[model samples]
Target: MLCPRCSLSETRVIETRTSEGGRVVRRRRECPSCGYRFTTYEKVEERGILWVVKKDGRRESFDRQKLLRGLMRACEKLPVPLDVLEEAASRIEALLRERESGEVLSLEVGDLAMEELRRINKVAYVRFASVYREFTDLSNFAAEIARLIEEREDKHDNH
Candidate 1:
């Protein structure tokens, strides 16, 4: 690593630690030529997953931001914290990485988001599902709400 103060090319690592739950490595380095110290982070670059096959048959690379944005929108006005949203995103990414095919269908992504949202908040879950499933009318929205209620009831019954 180059020294920030003197622009020297040589540096010695002084400390190292894992960050982001081991998703990245944080390193502290001192420049050999100028004694300047700086921090650097190293993250493993995952190979690109195959493009998502859209409902219209269009192919596009998987985008984490898109997933995050949808979650943010659904979570608006909900009591869920930002950390919860971030953890949900991290979990989704991990699931994608675990897939043997390295390619995820758009439908699969939507399902994953809905599953996470359901655990976060019911209102948020319905909001996301309505748009994601393209609800056409009030009946469709009502049906989703009823389904959620039934699922909750079933869970309670099981316990």
Candidate 2:
């Protein structure tokens, strides 16, 4: 690894450890030339491994941060925690990676996120669904809320 301070090509790893539930590997390094110390994180890149096919027929590389940001926005000012959203993002990424086609629709991603949010928080779910499903009018929101209520009722009956 190159040293950021002096741009030296040679660096030695001083320490190594796993983090974020073993999803990331962190390495502490020091530059021999400049004695600069820095930390580097290594994680498996899902980039180019999966593609998101947008509604307008454009294909873009799937980004986990982008997905998490959307979820955060939906849960903004709500009681939902960041860890919940992070886990949901990770689950969404994992499910997408399991696909054999190497491609998934943007709508599919949104639906997956909504599923996670719905289980975590109903308000957040509706907030996400409103934008994901493009709720332009009050009726759209009402219809979604109605469906959500009906699902709850069905589950209650089964229980």
Candidate 3:
């Protein structure tokens, strides 16, 4: 690795750690010449088309960061553990990859996100649904919450 301070091409990794459920590697590096130390993270890059078909008839390359950002926004200040969210994202990604066409509808992605968020936290689920479903008024939130409550009640009754 190149040293950021002196632009030296020689550097050595002082320590290495895995995080993000071992999906990412954190490397502590030092420049021998100037004793500059820095940290870097390494992640695996997906190798596939994985196009997303949007509602507006536009297709775009799949962006994992974009999805993670949305999840984080929903789970913000909600006491949801970061690893649980990451695992949900990972499962969603794996599900998409299992699809044969390498393409998925935008709504499908939103639905998957909603389901995953619901499994993590109801507040997060509603937060994500409010945006994904484009709530225009109070009724939207009320109806969604009512439906969620009904579903929970039904599941409880069944048990």
Candidate 4:
């Protein structure tokens, strides 16, 4: 690594750590000549563009910020922390990228988002689902809430 202070080409790493669920590498380096110390972070560059196949058949590049915005909107006024939502967004992006095909259906993305929200907060899950699933009637909302209740009951039974 190059030293920022003296523009030296040689720098020795003094410390190394991994964070962000091991997706990021942080390194502290020192320049021997200038005795300058600095920190750097390393992250894997996404290999290729992942396309989002819209419901209308229009294709666009997958945008993490857009996804995060949707999640944030659903979580507005809730006790959920922004960092928790950010981590959920990162996991969703990683899951999408792990697919073999570069293209993903919008429905699939919505499902994944719902899954994450359901784990984070039930109210937020319903909020997102009402929009993404286009809940047009009270019955729709009731059905989803009922499903959630049933799942909780089943989980409790298993435990």
- Which candidate wins on lDDT? 4
lDDT of candidate 1 over 4-100, digit per residue (tens): 8998887899999985567768899998787888899797877866567788888888887788889999999889887678668767877887888
Sorting all predicted structures by TM-score, with the top scorer first, yields: 3, 4, 2, 1
Best by TM-score: 3
lDDT of 3 by residue, 1-159 (tens): 889999999899999998767878989999999999999989887777899999999999888779989999999998988778877888888889889898999999999999999988999999999999999999999999999999999999999
Candidate 4 global TM-score? 0.77
Superposition error at 50 for model 4 (Å): 0.3
Candidate 1 residue pairs in clash (backbone atoms < 3 Å): none
lDDT by residue (tens digit), candidate 2, 48-159:
5689999999999898999999999989999988877887898899899998899999999998998899999899999989888889999999999999999999999999
- Which lDDT tens digits does candidate 4 get at residues 1-159? 889999999999999998667887889999999899999989898999999999999999999899999999999999999878878988999999999999999999999999999999999999999999999999999999999999999999999
**Model 4 residue 21 distance off true place after TM-score fit, in angstroms:** 1.2
Cα misplacement distance, residue 25 of candidate 3 (Å): 2.8
How high is the lDDT of residue 64 in model 4?
Answer: 89
lDDT for 18 in candidate 1 is: 81
lDDT of 1 at 82: 74
Clashes of 3: 0
